[model samples]
Target: MKLIKTEDAVGHVLCHDMTQIIKGVTKDAIFRKGHVVTEADIPVLLSIGKDHLYVWEKEEGMIHENDGAEILCSICKGDHIERGNVKEGKIDLFAECDGLFKVNIELLNKINYLGEMMIATRNGNFPVKRGDKLAGTRIIPLIIEEEKMENAKAIVGDEKILEVKPFIHKKVGIVTTGNEVFYGRIEDQFTPVILNKLKEYSTELVEHVILNDDHEKITEAIVNLINKGADFVICTGGMSVDPDDKTPLAIKNTGAEIITYGAPVLPGAMFLLSYFNGDIPVVGLPGCVMYSKRTIFDLMLPRLMAGERITYEEISKLGHGGLCLSCDICTFPNCGFGKGM
Candidate 1:
């Protein structure tokens, strides 16, 4: 790119977008990139205090901001994503479908570390709806060394750095294990809570079994649901350490590999997670999930629906941002709960 005086820039191509800002009215592009400077445009350019303007003048071994931005976009664009129109040497990526957003942190960091460019994105492993902004990319300067962007592409390799994994539509089975609710001595509130959460994803509760605090009955209910082709199973209540809390033992008896019996998150610390037949997941939720606005269950449910595997290490890492403040009008996920995981 080359800098030319606005007075002598008639017929030169604009290399960048120039903004016109009016205190209370507008802040928008007045001159767009690639606009050939006309004789009449000189007055407007001068009015905007453009004594000199960067004009497109290609130099060997260097890339213009627009091209550099495109390179950055290519590095991160993945499945179920749409790229917006390039404006001011920046491009925004949006989700084409409701899914889980993922970012390759190592590659992202390496691209940013290349300097003279930036790619900002939302936290990965979270739910995003169609048309949600996934990321934005731009080059810092009007021109950048071509070699730098190529190096970033090499680091990104053949695969893109960002992806949106579609949430799987699955049939869910809910088992409420509590003596009071099983015998109709008390109303069942846990079922509704679990049902409401399940609605957020494309999952249907195919079967619900209410069993008294009996490990054998709970185990039987889980096995029945699995046999009936339930993709996910949840057993609420009786997950605590009390002698009567038998949900953990029931899940164990099903021969499911227990991913975790407990988590470090508040309001759901006594949570239980296990996989049945090495595929379907069975979750034992604590009572707090029925009343608390958000819990560990809320944090990991999206990952599960997206078919992402959960490990003990991943659950342990949630402790850093696991404490929920329980705001009066909770805006979880938007808030800082379960961050950096």
Candidate 2:
């Protein structure tokens, strides 16, 4: 690219988009790239404080910013992700379905460290809706070294840096274990809370059983649901250390592989996660989830619905940002809780 005085150039092509920023009014590209500058366009260019403008010029080892942006987009695009038109040397990626968003952090970091290129994305392992912006990629300069973009692609290799795994329709079952609610002595609020959360993923609640804090009964209920083709089982209450809390023991007695008995996250430290016969996951939710709008359950549910087999190590990483601020108006997923886990 070559730079020429705006007033002296009337027939040259613009190499980059010229943005116009007005306080509280507008910030957008007024003159797009490759627009042939006319005599009357000089005054408008000067108004935007453009003393000199960049014009397209072929340079053998360098790439135009527009092409560089496309290369960056290609590296990040994966299943259920859509790309937007390039603007100002940037491309935005959107989700094509409501599902879990994932980022290959290692490759993302390597690509950013290579310099002059960047891919900014939303936090991974969270739910996103169709048409939501998942990520954006851009080249720093109007023109960049082709070798730099090549290095970025090499860092990503065959793996996509960004992906949106569509959530699968799972048949869920709930077993609320509390003597007060089982006998109808008190209203059962846990079932409604669990149902509402499942509704967000389009999951169907296949069966629900209310039983007292009896390990044998809980175990039997879980087995019955699984045998009936329930995708997974959820046992609420009785997950704590109290004598009456036997949900954890019930899940253990069912011979499910316990991935974790407790999490580092607040509002869900007593949570239990296990796999039944190495397939169906059985979750034991604490009482906090019934009251708190967001918890460890919200963080891990998307991953589970996306068919991910989470490991204990991954759950252990939740300690870093597991404490919720409990803002007056809870805006979960957008909050800092359970980030980078």
Q: Quantify how close model 2 is to the true structure by its C-alpha RMSD in Å.
A: 4.2
Model 1, C-alpha of 265: deviation from truth (Å): 1.1
Tens-place lDDT digits, model 2, residues 75-123: 9999999999987689999999898999989888988988888889889
lDDT of 1: 0.89
Query: What lDDT would each prediction earn against the true structure?
Result: 0.89, 0.89
Clash count, one per candidate: 0, 0
**Candidate 2: which pairs clash?**
none
Once model 2 is optimally superposed onto the true structure by TM-score, how far is the C-alpha of residue 274 displaced, in angstroms? 0.8
lDDT of 1 at 319: 82
- Lowest lDDT sum, 10 consecutive residues, model 1, at 58-67
